[model samples]
Target: MISQLFSGIAVLSLIVLLLILLLRRLKQPYFIAYIAAGILLGPHAFNIIHEPDVIKQAGEIGIIILMFSIGSEIDLEYLTRNFYKPLLITFVQILMSFICMYSIGAYLDWKITIILLTTFIISLSSSAIVFQYLARTGEIKSQLGMITCGVLLMQDILVIPMMLTLNFMSGNTVSMQQLIKVCAGGLLMILFLRGAITKRLFKIPMQKELTADHELQIFIGFSICFTMAWISGWFGLSTAFGAFAAGILIGHDKATHWLGESLIPFRVFFMSFFFLAVGLQLNINFFIENAATIILISFTVIFINSLINTILFKLAENSWRDSLYGGALLSQIGEFSFILMTMAAALKLVENYTYQITLAVITLTMLLTTIWLMIIQRLIYRLS
Candidate 1:
């Protein structure tokens, strides 16, 4: 069994290396390349992985690491400095998305849970993708960029509540008192941590101390993340909530910067595998058979969502150009959608077909986001 595991890793690594080389030459993003590699190596294609369940478990760890990194790197001070704009956008967008998606789901006779999950998945934009593009294009400090950043941050914050809501709705037989207890527990945990930080009850290691033992510093960060995750689970919250909270706690510590840096390589390695696992679940034949439906659905969702968001931004006193820019950038489904969808599947909230379709739609939207942004830019320039 160990030999088979080693053989599988070797094949997967070889495939990843070759794809990375080719994708680099083509200038494709790492996530796309990883997904492509999975398609080629997955059971739907080459059938190289004999134990996909193992890969799936490892991928979950990658997600936990990714969430931890997100939490730790979040610059709350910067976000607070420019809070209202993003908060407004995030609130309005989610409100509109929920109303619209709920109406559609009801009309189609879907389950309430399915409708709720769909609203959360499609309404939120991909912060990782949008922020990367904005930074690469040197727009991170621009007015529109700041608004985009603020909105993305707000969406991420919403993930905690969404996770809790999912848990409550998961058909588990829990009393209202238990639910209240969980909520109170989470709130108390936050307060306790805040008080501790204020009182300096737990001092962050000094840089000089960590500098002498780099490995120890990294372990400390992981220890904090995992510990918080376990505590969160104990309170009936998702491990991600705890991990993210752990990040926000240590994120502000000066000595923790090196810890965050040290985890980068591991995060990247694991995240790649996470995307690969998503690809492995792709039913290539199903996707191919429904290629036209996928395209039409993707186009419709992107178009309609962008149009609604642009109007909302405009109503908020943003210029048409900026509104359109923000809308276009946010039209695609985000990485969080994948996480939520996986959770929803586990809870049996969505059908097998709905899961496949949503995954394919998200992938298509992400791929087109760049092209869509360029097109919007050209249109704005021409109009100006």
Candidate 2:
């Protein structure tokens, strides 16, 4: 038993170590490499290791910590000031991306469920990835970066209701009345929590870091996240919605700065596991098997996705450089896309081949995006 445990540690360690080396050498973002490492150990070609049930179960914690940390960093004043731009851009992006992608789905003769999933997925950019990239590049204070941040936050907020709508629509048991209740409850929760309830939380002082306060803060935070999640579930919304609502609430609190500082270390540590888990689920052979179709769809999505995002950003009174910046930040598929596809597959709305194809495309896009960004960085900075 001891040997088994040690071997697992060694394997995980080696995977992360290899990723670090690749990241340094390639001058690419570590996230791409991390996901690649997970794929290397996945049961596809390597067949050397599988992400056991235990590991996947543990990944749940990673998700929470990540969402929680995001909440803490959210500056209510900053975000609110920039909100209108993101709100408009996000709505346009979602509306246009769905309409355009859904048309392609029609040509592909995709089923309604598959079409819906595609629409949902295409509307999103990876929040975790984009935020981290902006921070790392020291652009978080730049106007373009600030706009992107607001847009991403708006996207997350938009997704909450969309998720509830999807859940209601996707269910066999849901009635019109039931759907109305869910929507109403969600709207009410968002307003109540984000407005009055959260304002009260912000009114409290956390000027001093009292002893043992860190533990209490974490408990309070996790409680709020879990509680919101539970309420969302009860109202037929997904757990992510609750997490988002939790973030918005936490963001409002004046003590959010300290909360951010306290939670970041934990977020970084655990989210590493989340990325690794994503990698371990990808099978190279499966991706290769569907290479032709996956490439076609992925490239098409990337091009159009970038175009739509660019157009929206420009319309929002942003510089052309800012438009391209937004495009570059988004020029790929994301985690939520895969989650929606998986759900569709389970419901027989899509086949396994569809899910595999989307995953392959998303991975390729993500990998390519790093290179895409670097090559354009100089030109973008000059123009901006």
Best by lDDT: 1
- Model 2 Cα lDDT, one tens digit per residue, 160-225: 555554565567455778778678877877677656544574343454652248886666666777
**Each prediction's Cα lDDT score?**
0.77, 0.70
> Cα deviation of 98 in candidate 1 (Å)?
2.6
> Judged by TM-score, which candidate is best?
2
- Candidate 1 Cα lDDT to native: 0.77
Model 1 residue 293 lDDT?
88
Runs of candidate 2 with Cα error greater than 4 angstroms are 3-5, 48-54, 157-171, 176-178, 196-217, 251-256, 381-384
lDDT of 1 by residue, 1-384 (tens): 568778878987888888888878977666777778777888889888756667667766666666677667666566556678778878888888888888988899978887788888888787657765775678866777767767776787677678667877896655687678678867877786666556655657566888778788788878988888888777766566677677767876766677777777877787777778767877788899889989998887788779877987787679999999888999998877887897888887778888899988887887777778778989999988
Per-candidate clashes come to 0, 3
The runs of at least 3 residues in candidate 1 whose Cα sits more than 4 Å from the true structure, single-residue gaps closed, are 81-87, 106-114, 127-150, 153-172, 196-202, 312-322, 343-349, 380-384
* Native-to-model Cα distance after best TM-score fit, residue 216 in candidate 2, in Å: 4.2
**Steric clash pairs (candidate 2):** 38-279, 38-280, 39-279
